[model samples]
Target chain A: MLILSRRKDETIIIDDKIEISIVDIKGDQVKLGINAPRSVKIYRKEVYLEIEKENAAAARSSDALASLGDLFKK
Target chain B: MDNDVKQISIPSGLYGFEGLTKFALTRASQEPFLLLKSLEEESLSFILIDPLYFRPDYTPDLSDEDLKEIGEEKENNLYALAIVTVRPGEDPQMTANLQGPIIINGDTLTARQCITSNPKWQTRHDILAEIRSHQGAESC
Candidate 1:
């Protein structure tokens, strides 16, 4: 992992397109501000991973989903 | 299998299936659930539902970047859907990921799965239990 120390208000540019800045730091929590192109999509690491897991589970035609056809109407 | 298949383009191509872009959004037999069938991969399909249906207070304020990503200007023009997760059993449990809501632009047919900033929302929420719990409160 590439570790770089940056103080508050310090900015890091990626590919000259996306910019990440440290907005504030207090205790163990740090607030960040990201500036990227509209084409670039950003998400929290935990939220992104959760969505990926949910999407993977939804891809298959599970017995639970398959049986849902009769569950809702009933 | 019939008509009413709306072509939706997920620019980000969702979380897991990032490669697959084109999809067909059609109504399922039930009113609450919709079928998100992928055109590229025939087997790739998912059951979708509006998270708001389960949680009326679920108001996910999309960031400006989220709106631009889907080419949507007004937030009202965007339709949101969550991929349903069902557990297999005699009394199967179904949940919706309110944390990450899929935003779609009706005019442009562009869509994006965006993470909500709301602290109240969760990745997996019990859809059936939520409805039933609300029903009891309403009757009281």
Candidate 2:
């Protein structure tokens, strides 16, 4: 991981397409403004990880879904 | 290869299963639950549920970028299916991932698991409890 120090209002450009700007800085929280192509998907690291973890757990329980058939009686 | 199988292509795939772009959507033995079987890996599959079936007010606020990626506009023939997770034991518990719903475009059959910006949604929503609560409200 390349770590670079940037103060507020500083911007980092990736591949000359994606731009990540440091919008605001409070004591601990740092707000970011990202400009990227529509194809690029942006997400918070923790939110993305949570979805990944949930997907993995859901995949593992596929066989157990048969038991749930009784719950939905329509 | 079944006639009932609907081919779905997720260019970016799911959060964890990124390499798997192709999948087959088929109805499970259950009425509402659907099976999302990976075409690349035979052993991998997931049970999907239409969140709106239980949570009638479920409206995932999809970003324009996410919609464009799937070649769709907001709510234009889009089917949002939540991945179901079943916890087995003496009393089995089931939950659905509402935070990241698998959004499929009906026309093109393209799909993507989109993460909503709403903090109210979460990875695990108690399916049975939600149903019971709905039933409890109806009786009043």
Candidate 3:
């Protein structure tokens, strides 16, 4: 892992396209501003991890489709 | 190529099952459940359900980048299916993952699991409870 110490208002450029800037810092919270192309998809780390975990659990679901079919019947 | 199965290619693949990109999508032996079976692996599969079936106003609020990734033009031929999680037990409880829905382009057969920023959407939503509540409301 690459580690660099940057202060507020400092910006880091990646691949000559994406830019990450330290927008604000107060106490334990720090705000970041990212500038990337439209093709780039960015997400909060925890949110992404939660989705990944849920997908894994969904894949392990039991073969209970037959039992649940009646629930949809009107 | 089974007559009922539709081949879908997810270039980026699902988050945890990233390597298994090719999938055979077919309706389960049920009214509203669909089975997404991975072509790369036999044991891997997911049961899907249209979120709107339970949550009538399930607007995922997909981002522009998400739409572009799936090649969605004017939102035509796009379908969003939520992955269902069915717990194993005597009385199984089922939940749907609405936060990250599998968006498929019917015309191109390309799909991607997209995450929504909406606070109302979550990874697990009780399917039975939702339906029961709706039924109670309708009866009134």
Q: Identify the leading candidate in terms of lDDT.
A: 2
Looking at candidate 2 chain B, the ten consecutive residues that score lowest on lDDT are B67-76
- Relative to the true structure, candidate 2 reaches a TM of 0.83
The candidate that achieves the highest TM-score relative to the unseen native structure:
3
Stretches of model 2 off by over 4 angstroms after superposition? A8-42, A71-74, B1-3, B74-76
**Model 3 DockQ vs. reference:** 0.61
lDDT of each: 0.81, 0.89, 0.86
Q: Which candidate should be chosen as best, given DockQ against the real structure?
A: 2
Candidates sorted on DockQ, descending: 2, 3, 1
Q: Where does candidate 2 clash, by residue pair?
A: none
Error of 1 at A62 (Å): 5.8
Report how far residue A1 has shifted in candidate 1, in Å: 4.4
Predict model 1's lDDT versus the native.
0.81
Give a tens-digit lDDT track for model 1, residues A1-74.
Answer: 98999999999999999999999999999999999987676767877787788888877643255577666654
Better of 1 and 3 by DockQ: 3
| Accuracy of chain B in candidate 1 (TM-score) | 0.91
